[model samples]
Target: MERLQKVIAQAGVASRRKAEELITQGRVSVNGEVVTELGTKVTPRKDKVEVDGVPIDREEPVYFMLYKPTGVISSVKDDKGRKVVTDFIDSEQRLFPVGRLDYDTSGLLLLTNDGEFANQLMHPKYKVGKMYIAKVKGIPTRESLRQLERGIMLEDGKTAPARVKFVSGNKSQGTSIIEITIHEGKNRQVRRMFEAIGHPVLKLKREMYGFLNLKGLNSGEARELRPHEVKQLREIVEKNKCN
Candidate 1:
């Protein structure tokens, strides 16, 4: 017998942490009875497990990298009928975005049916850096850029120090392009960071997540991750786990 949440995660219904929430919320059931305890365990072969009254089938995991387009939601489903990241890929397994990009933000996004892998990569303790390029409303001076590099205060709290690079600026247009790398995953963080420094982002695109990038794919396109790439990702997170 294995932990119920583990089985649920392996079945790709949700991440292990999310499975725990579903269990505690009384949304999971084992053998026709609702399970609310986190410690519940069962045999995947004998016990009939269900999430939201739907039986889950354990399918082999799949991973894909999407050059997500703007105006698309980074989710499996959107309540308002918006296009989602999963809609860009054709797959037999139920896949979900690793973390999230805002509805208007576009660029490299990872999707997978491996809940455990997704959970590990998204965990704050891993400290995976995401790099983004943004066109802001005003040119940021060296001191303002340095303030971002040294860490700045936001409504949520003070952000961690970031790697900020000034790309270019158009004095006449009153705009500048800046590249920044950050480890935090706060909602609308990139936009907020610039806004706090008096230069709100007018356009933004995520260029990298860890070492992954949108090399050959165009917007709205996706490709399966190579086995070696997946192995490298696992190694990266595992190595971080040891530190």
Candidate 2:
């Protein structure tokens, strides 16, 4: 037997924290009996569990890739009254983002309730690479690009060297699109890197995280990841040691 919240999470009902909320609210029951206590235990296979009077199913895990749009915060909640990423999802299971994308930035974001999966993707020591397309105010000089390739001293310290390339630019218009791949997960790292070189990023979007891409997914839309896709992601994470 396991704790009720763990059972709920393992059954894909919600994240462990949200499951505990449901229990406290008297929304979860076992065998038709309300169980509002936090540490109540039950056998998932032997006892019938329900949330809001609906039976919970123990199915395969769910993973989702969402094309995040600008203006949506990446967190689960914002005490400052800003809209959050969860507002875009309508799943019965409580899910959280694997990492974060700043409110003004947009692109591929992963959502899952599996804590282990989330941990694997977020741990920086794993060096999981993420690719981004950045639009900057000025066309970066080759020297500036070289500086980025080597490493830049930020307020935090010198950043790790990243793979940087010039995709295209309109020098006449003083704007350029550059592709960058970095293994570290720093707060506003990409933007800061360009800003340090006097090329303030006007827009930024992550195109890929590790081996996962945002192909065919439109902004604000999401879908469950295929089993093969999940396997590929796991393999990539393991191979790259992203966590």
Off by over 4 Å in 2: 1-60
Q: Name the best candidate (by lDDT).
A: 1
Worst 10 residues of 2 by lDDT: 115-124
Candidate 2 structure, TM-score to reference: 0.74
For each candidate in the order shown, give its overall lDDT on alpha carbons: 0.93, 0.86
**Which pairs clash (backbone N, Cα, C closer than 3 Å) in model 1?**
none
TM-score of each: 0.94, 0.74
Model 2 CA lDDT for position 28: 94
Q: Please count the clashing residue pairs in each candidate, in the order shown.
A: 0, 2
Number of the top candidate by TM-score? 1
